[model samples]
Target chain A: QQQVKQSPQSLIVQKGGISIINCAYENTAFDYFPWYQQFPGKGPALLIAIRPDVSEKKEGRFTISFNKSAKQFSLHIMDSQPGDSATYFCAASKFNTGKLIFGQGTTLQVKP
Target chain B: EPEVTQTPSHQVTQMGQEVILRCVPISNHLYFYWYRQILGQKVEFLVSFYNNEISEKSEIFDDQFSVERPDGSNFTLKIRSTKLEDSAMYFCASIGASTDTQYFGPGTRLTVL
Candidate 1:
């Protein structure tokens, strides 16, 4: 129940296109959700995040759409660029405990 | 732009040897954590520390593993005896007083042979 399952093991999007990745979790206790972007040989970096209380959160080109009832969330990247190509991870955690359960990760490739 | 930092970008140790991975979280961050990721695998939560104490740990954080905050600025994870299976990328993360964001270090790649 602690697993955060992510979809599209790999994704290829054209430049100026939209790229999306989905994730689901069975742990209802998870109140915090975050997305991370990792370059090769580098640790994951915080990209965007959303709480269960909000349906969606957007920051520049990255947005997180969350559905509390479905226990699902997704990350959407607008105007996909080659620089955005990397492994993206979705994670869930409880606010108080702060232990993150990460998804398998999605390798996104934006073609130029 | 305070970010977490880790030492020895890569560590190579033989089996049964002891090794310690070190990290320095953001200065003002109050929560610290350690997570591991095998090649092409998901990030596995190892442990979380808050207020200088372990708040929680996963099954993967076995008896062989120990965490310490010996000083105000550093946090460390020690393996009493390393094994071949311990080879992976170890990451240290930290979050400030707010609970939503966690900043991760560059990671220490542990290669046990």
Candidate 2:
């Protein structure tokens, strides 16, 4: 049972374009949604996170748009750069659980 | 900037041997966790440790696997008998009590033959 599902296993975008990755979850108990970026041979780094109370959060060029009613969230990267080419993973976890349920990763490629 | 640190970025061991992976989480963090990622697979949670004990563990964490916080700074995962299926990249993460964001270590790639 994959609690969180992500679409478009791979993505390609031109430089300065908007790169978008979408994720959905079935568990209503999930309150914390986060996006992680991982480069090859390294660990996943926290990119952006949003709580259920907020409809959207923007950090630098990264934005997370969350829709609680639809049980969906999406990550948008504005001005996508070639350096941003890597794997992105969306994760969800409930309070006090300390266990993150991750979605299938999306590999993004930005062509300069 | 505080970050999680792991030892032996890569380890190669034979089947039926014992291997212990070590991690040093951030100094101020209290919650610790272990996760594994197989080649081209999503990260899977193995166990979570809090208050000096395991709070939760996944079904994949069997009796052959064990986690211990031997000291104030070191968290270790020991696999009693390594199997070929245990080959994967193991990551350690830590979070503070006030935040839900987890900081991850650089991961250790374990290869079992």
Candidate 3:
């Protein structure tokens, strides 16, 4: 079973537009949600993270809006740029579990 | 910034051969983990190690697989007999004492023929 589900396998947005990716998880034990960005032939890098305690967290131009009761979270990129074109993965994990359950992934393309 | 380092960016091994992948985690990190990603697939967790012992592992980690912290800084994963299905990109990650964020290595592309 896929523990976490992501929507819009691919996305395209114009520069200065907002790009969004959403993910949902079935396990309530998940307390930490993180978004990772991966470029071709490279490892995934941490983009932003949020705990269940907060409904929203923002870092730079990236923001994570989490709804604990709905078991859903979404990543929003403001003013999307061509450099933002990459694959994004949303992950969930229980505290101290040491392992993350990752979503299928979303490929984003920012057209200049 | 300190980052995890993995050896041999790519390895091509024959079937039924034993292969060991090595990783050197950050100096102050306490948790180490191994994950794999098949082509165009989501990253899958293999195992997690802490304090020289395994803290968690996934179902995909079978008897043919084993992990060891041979020294203070080196963590290794061994596959007793590799199969064609083992071909994938293996990534090593480490987390420090203060944060839950994991820093990942560039990954070693293992090709089992």
Chain A TM-scores of each predicted structure, in the order given, are 0.99, 0.97, 0.97
Task: State the lDDT of candidate 3 residue by residue for B1-113, as single tens digits.
Answer: 88899988999999999999999999989999999999999999999999888999999999999999988899899999999999999999999999899999999999999
Which candidate, 1 or 3, would have the higher DockQ against the true structure? Answer: 1
Docking outcome class, model 3: high
- What are the per-residue Cα lDDT tens digits for candidate 1 across B1-113? 78899998999999999999999999989999999999999999999999888999999999999999999999999999999999999999998996558899999999999
Write one digit per residue (lDDT tens) for candidate 3, span A1-112.
Answer: 3399998899999999999999999998888999999999999999999999999999999999999889999999999999999999999998687599999999999999
Model 2, range B1-113, lDDT digits (tens) per residue? 99999988999999999999999999989999999999899999999999999999999999999999999999999999999999999999999988888999999999999
The best candidate by DockQ is: 1
Candidate ranking under DockQ, highest first, comes to 1, 2, 3
lDDT of the structure predicted as candidate 3:
0.94
Candidate 1 CAPRI-style tier: high
Worst 10 residues of 3 chain B by lDDT: B1-10
DockQ of candidate model 1:
0.88
- lDDT (Cα, tens digit) per residue for candidate 1, span A1-112: 9999999899999999999999999999999999999999999998998999899999999999999999999999999999999999999998888889999999999999
Instruction: Give the TM-scores of the predictions, in the order they appear.
Output: 0.98, 0.98, 0.98
- Expressed as tens digits, the lDDT of each residue in A40-101 for candidate 2 is 99999999999999999999999999999999999999999999999999999987786999
Kindly give the number of clashing pairs for every candidate.
0, 0, 0
